[model samples]
Target: MKTPKFLLPVGLACATVLSLLSAFNMPSWANFKDAPKEIIDEVWQVVNREYVDPTFNNQNWQETRRKYLAKDYKSREDAYKSTREMLKGLGDPYTRFMDPKQYESMKVETSGDYQGVGIQLGLDEKTHELTVVSPIEDTPAFTAGVKPKDVLLSIDGRSTKGMDIDQAVNFIRGQAGTSVALKFRREGKPLTLSLVRTRIELKPVKYSLRTEGDRRVGYIRLSQFNAYAAKDMGNAVAKLTREQADGFILDLRSNPGGLLYASADIARLWLSEGTIVSTVDRDGQRESITVSRPAMTSKPLVVLVDGASASASEILGGALQDHHRAVLVGTRTYGKGLVQSVHSLSDGSGVAVTIAHYQTPSGRDINKKGIDPDIKVELTKEMAKNLKADQVATLADPQYARAVDVLGQQIAGMPVEQVVAAAGKPFPAERQPVAAENQTPVATP
Candidate 1:
């Protein structure tokens, strides 16, 4: 793996506005109280000052604030509803309003303890259908044979058609002893599964040393890019390299994404020296992040991605592909180049404002256009649903098998270099049809 640097950029106009963001960026569950009008104003002010799209989706930002503030909000619920209405005008699903429960749920999933059926959900911007981003390992959803990209049809007899991310999560989560029924479609067949809710622990990284032919392959399945992902990944790489793994396969199949900085740290593990990724603001100014440290391993590498892979997954995958540090396998990624900076307001409710958009090292804007893998191995619905966790990175998994074959070729012809080559002609810049419309991680479980 090479050591690459990653960064998220935020445009700050002045110290006054910067301090305003700092004060409002408290923990989602923090105890805070304010009038409904005050809370509404705070959210509007933040979006106006820092939203990545200075044009505010071609609408008047000042008029938007005045319109929302003019309405009389009797309670926080009223304010939240109005806030969501304001965000919708931006035409960006990534920048949305999160009630206290939803924000706290997101916080627990990405950084703290959480409870649920062990599933992360996403919304398709085009269809407005709730889909499975991933099922956290060792959770009820995973055990019930839930797979990524399954189009959610209903939850507890309620249809998910036209449902946004927030509504789906609120329906799925409940008390630990409660059971929830989820109906989704896979390969044109409908299936319903009932799962008992429970406390879910966020275990981000799962690794194994697999024997393929005569080569030892280090298999690392990053379920999500949470707080613990990078550290766990480092440990996995170190231990596997110690065991003399000939190559490594980093699997980011269904990961929806988590923390931004966590993705940065994980990219550095495989990049030695090069500009990993860059962030561009609305004004066309750019900030590029580069690292010159030695890579953890110069061994051959491959990354597996699918339609459910979004956000931080795209960031890490893009960097590796740009540096040619790892060959990408599987299908095109979910496009989510926009970066959202989430902040909890005084009333515990939170706002995720699109602060900037990222570009691949080759200056590819993968917003509506996702990154195409170097080796495309189409994953059929049957194949995605039939493979068990244990079978991944083994012969039974078609994508992993293809990754191994590609890794084997690299191993046979690669040299033993301590540092990866500098960026020359990166992997062919290709874009594919966008799969999921929105892939925001809005819940913990």
Candidate 2:
């Protein structure tokens, strides 16, 4: 899920005030017989005021608005179509238009509750194809054996050739118990699967203390950075710390990021100081966030990431890596670093506009170029299929086992570079010693 910009505390407050004013006041636009046109104009005004790119992808914004407004929209559907066309000119798939139902479904998703096959979808930046980011663990899609990097060919037998992410989402999600047929291109081979949609109340954070030889290791798998992710993560860290856990492995594999504030808040849990992340707005003004309070835990930490880790996942991983706060293991991340702010139109419809681009503390813009792990472990499809939810964090999971080995070295007061196991293969660890200026105190195991 792309982080909902306006849902953050300050933005939410501003939105609340605007909503209240719009509700009570009698607006002249309310009486427009062609109210559909009003929506088109509203979307235009929003993009005019808030889009991250002042050039609007080098298009003539006012002229384009004139062209769209000149058309006589027959219905709300017609206006929606025109609005989508208008947004598409910016050439950003992340900035999308959603109808009322799609908007509501998106809201439910950030709440960590929704009805669907439980798959996170993405548009490939390079291929321009609708791709599966990852499947939510133990959900219908995951159980059905859908894998990451899978290209979605069609939905319900309809071609997905030119369909945008939101449109494909509408086709796949339905009332619980409903079924949708999805054809995917994996390994250049066509494979089809049918999944029954179900109401998914996702638990954003799952943690347990594991006994690895003589060390007590805390395992926390963060599946999403939804609304409740920060609180749940804090609770898990505190509980594990109370249990005298020697170190921690924070698994962010396949965690399609959630709310922006959630990532910032979760970063505060691990980082006592240093920049969490920073954003550059349309005018080039930069905003950087850092936690002033003490962290929840200072024990040695290692992070697990993969190709499906994106957006806020990249944000958190980048911040920690740059600050020398944690050692990362696995493949590079899913590069989706642009920030979006979703807005509800006067009508029930909504629009997600790309409002800002962010950077890590070290000033790395991990947009298309994702952050690389210190230890690169290529988990093949066969290995992934065998590593179910129950097997994760266990010896059966190579990535998790690799992370455990790194954390073990840290607990033993050894440099991270000494650890050399990737999926049981002798791989060179890319861990660089913490920069002299970036060192922070941590508890020794």
- lDDT agreement with native, every candidate: 0.74, 0.78
Instruction: Write model 2 residue lDDT over 1-445, tens digit each, in one string.
Output: 1122353311111122232223212244455534788777777767777788999999999888779877887899999999998998999888788898887777777667788998888888668899988898879998998978899999988999978887888889889999999999998999999999999888889999999889899999998887788899999999999999999999999888877778888998888876677777798877776666888888899999998898888888987777667888999998777877677776777877788888777777788888888788888878876777778779888998888888988898764444434234342333231222332221111
lDDT of 1 at 48: 73
Best by lDDT: 2
Question: Candidate 2 — which residues are off by over 4 angstroms?
Answer: 1-34, 381-390, 415-445
* Candidate 2 global CA lDDT score: 0.78
Q: After the best TM-score superposition of candidate 2, give how far the Cα of residue 82 lies from its true spot, in angstroms.
A: 0.7
* TM-score for predicted model 2 compared with the true structure: 0.87
Clashing pairs in model 2, backbone N/Cα/C closer than 3 A: none
